[model samples]
Target: MSSRSMLLALAAVLLQTPALTQAFQDDLLQQCGTTTVFSNHRQGRLRQSGVSRVVGGIPSPEGSSPWMVSLQLLHPGMGYVGHICGGVLIHQSWVVTAAHCIKNEKYALPISHLWSVQFGPELKRFAIKEIVIHEMFAGYNHDIALVQLSNPAPYVPVCLPKSGQGFQGIRCVASGWSTTSAAPTTLTRRMGIPGPRAHVHLSVVSSSVCRNRYLSAYNITLNAGHLCAAGKGLLTSGTCLGDSGGPLQCNMADGRWYLAGITAFGSGCGRPGYPDVYTRLAYYLPWIKVQIKKHESAEKSGNYL
Candidate 1:
């Protein structure tokens, strides 16, 4: 079969399989609260070894471009552990990701280690000067954060949608190596170890539908600043355990990619009914700007306080 035909056939198989959706969702949702999504090891006592940060490295884009980018975080002793989180390269040195993915922690590593940035789906390394979390995002209200690399990425990063722009029912793809494991059968504090296979999938969902389902649970009030997307069918295919901090990118009429959301939470990976939730990046631009300014000021003064 031709490559195009092969891709179509594969997509058909993916959209038709409820089990695949369930598997994807289960992995991503299982990752919440298990330390930052960038950290590769499972929750519990932090591991001295293993890929420690982010979900997994970015995979190659097969077509024009996959609507996803890579995220890497600092891990102690392990060097920089890469994971898949959805993000848009907004500027030369800055990219946006979910605050929950790297929030609360002032440094990417534990203040005792170094962190680096890797861009595109290829997992190349770059030096990251600092990570700036939205000041207003104390817990979850505004769950967006930014990473400023020491240099620009080689690949063209996606840009943020203009303020007030909106999208629905767009064919979007988020790529990441998701953990392949279900939540422990029982409700216990401990979680199962996610398998090593890195995974990625495609889905198309509406903003209103996602808001109606997730707003109450995540405590978000959608507005011009917030953009949303979701998957349809009996099961929604999405980013899973290793897919946190990734982007939900949608295409626009002008043919440029616009970042619509950042993976935040979901009722589960691909439950038949529940929709995945993401932190609305545009909603918290003011906070993001403030953070950038703070970092700049600190740099100018030679102090980070």
Candidate 2:
């Protein structure tokens, strides 16, 4: 069958299934928090070895981050607009990303269908059904958004935190497209391609430290909702400009990796003092459920259709 026809068939199967939050949480999802593809010899730890960081990011194997989804916007004339931001596959058809990726500075929401999901090795393109930004989002504070896929993605979903989970000071990892600044000033940049897609290890910083540091340097007062993490190792590089909306995953004693944060903003390409900011996933779990259920209800009643 034709590719378009097959995608339509897949979409048909998705529609027949309930997009209800409970069903999505309990039934649709599988054993999450485990990475069989980009896995480690030990059960609880993510693979932090092998790949080396030159400028900032380390090249994570393509399928290593199974839950990472690239959110792209499609244009009519230009077409094929690549990854604008990174996102995590939270539910079968729902993804979590930075709110600023969707909502404009003027608070305008973009047309949902123009955006698509590129997943797996083949970059299977899935259309977007809806875009939901946090109502309380203003400036960069609560920078989180939810996207409903037109069809279910046949990939593993990352686990969400039940509570705050006290992940502070814990080491976590984030994966996304690297920043051009993170690449060596070598032939790749000379050839116009720099900052390959990769991941970075970060030590989650305390909110007080983050607020104190940023408040002094940038005069930005961060609250509890925002998460802060800095690069590990002597080089001290981390999530850069283009890496926004990527998954900031933290592992717990349960031997499961949980979606900890959404890469929100940073001063530069892993600058020394300016640690990358992320929208704390644990802080917004309740709001995420509320938004998902509210919209899922609309979808079931054909209100969204």
Candidate 3:
């Protein structure tokens, strides 16, 4: 069969299968087993080993951001698995990410099309139980989604902000396996060999400043749901390709890291003056709580579909 035809056939198969009843789902969960208990904070006894920080950014010490996760998909015809985006483990079974990460513009694929959520120091893979995309998401505006894992993994979830909390001007960190080089060849190689994740320090830019900058350049005003940040002048420090859906986390006064934003879009990776934009978590807190509650209610009633 032709390559295009083959892809069509595979996508058909993926779409036809029930997301919650794939044959490998049970086996994959069983094989993974219950290895570690989930928590919002890392235990002192747990070993810290695999963390690394991002583009034009410094290398973070290993295992620093335990909530970081790589969302991937398998391309059978291409003979490779691809890391399409990054996400955060928000709960034992729930993950938060950019809605665009899971939506295919060319084709409306099923949730089962997602290969797995690779996380932890060893980057173990886990099957997704369900996917919930924000109903109001349009392009990059409200670009957040949630994924429920078939089984919980051994990792710490990131702390979420309470309603009405704000994070303006706060220094935060964004980490992901995004490519550092702008060259095409480097991008391809980086995607294949996704090395240690990298992180960078960024200061939150107020909505007025961000809106003014974008309005002046792209004739687009920043929305209320968006948050912006950048590194020190012309330093070229920020997220790049493959970093979408990753968390922009801030350390609170209480000593716990709370997710401040979700990497959404930017003019270019680490480009001076074009600060990175994220979907502000504060604006979507109520929506998130509702989705979690709805999912929990469905699960309790054995209607998890």
Candidate 4:
């Protein structure tokens, strides 16, 4: 059998092995070459195919709102490489994304690699001032981190969900130029090549269901404090690359979108029978607040500070 098949089968077996939890984690790291990149050379073919649609309440703003930001990784030799992960425009200056997206050396994209934050849905860009990853976050903990923009973005801030807010049943929306399917289908099949593909999607999902069902496959650490959002339809709606570091907002009391989660992981791009996962923003508010304070303080101290 192929290595991918072996690992899947192993994962299936370990699902039943209580003693194997450590073993499973080790195997996942070893077999998958577990970096923040989360690549399985064999599984790359599984990511293609997700569908897209417009966000409901938020209409297009004239000349771009200050709210949205696209986090791009810039390598000195490579120029601007776009969207290593998704993030949200919480404050005019600070953006939030998964720590794993900006973590340690294993799959770490260098801090110097970050070039800019492009705002607006059409993706016009701007340079960033600094990236402050949380000091305590080990990245494996999959905590939150921030990217400070050089200038304030013009969009409005979305509502922040309370810390520890479970997305168990909430219907929420995620927006980004993430991944959307070019077409839709019912069957789950893996295709395409082994590198990254762009094109993004926005979708709604059920957190509770996704956490219970695909947690093992998707590298979910529920206690680590992330949220999950299942897709609304089969092969119809969800996130893709370039959609990283974006918002998962819920339709709230005032009919405005409340920031519920940040896009995280999923089995595939709106793959049939699966949900898109997001980082529970409610769980990370303190971290966001702290990071923003540091950035703000730095700005006050000196331009480089």
The prediction achieving the highest lDDT against the true structure is: 2
TM-score of 2: 0.77
TM-score of each: 0.59, 0.77, 0.75, 0.61
* Candidate 2 lDDT tens digits, 1-305: 54356445545533454334554555537667767444332111112111111233555665566778777754455443345677899987799988887775533545786677767655456778888888888887888889998767666788898786657777777777554244356443222222445666777876786788789988887987888877653134364443667888887787777888888876555566667788888899999999889888987898865
> By lDDT, highest first, what's the ranking?
2, 3, 4, 1
* lDDT for each residue of candidate 1 in 1-305, tens digit (9 for 90 to 100): 44346334433432342222434534433331121122122221001013222233233224323324445443455433344244555654466776666644534331211434444334345555676666566554566778775544434455565555445566554434333234324311111122232323334456666567656665655544444444445254353322555666565566555566666655543544555555665566566667778777887899964
List of clashing residue pairs for candidate 3 = 50-63, 51-62, 51-63, 53-60, 53-198, 53-199, 54-198, 54-199
| Per-residue lDDT of model 4, residues 1-305, tens digit only | 55456335433432332222444434432322111211112111113222222221232224322344555554455543344545666655567776666664645653632446655544445556677766766643556677766555544555566666655555554555423234323211121111112222234445555566665666654554556554435344454321455666665455555677666666544556666566667777787777677667766788555
Model 4 misplaced regions, further than 4 Å: 1-66, 103-113, 121-124, 136-140, 178-209, 215-220, 233-237, 240-242, 301-304
Task: Please give the CA lDDT of all the candidate structures.
Answer: 0.47, 0.67, 0.66, 0.50
TM-score of 4: 0.61
What is the clash count for each candidate, in the order shown? Answer: 21, 1, 8, 30
Q: Which is the leading candidate under TM-score?
A: 2
**How many pairs of residues in model 1 come into backbone collision?**
21
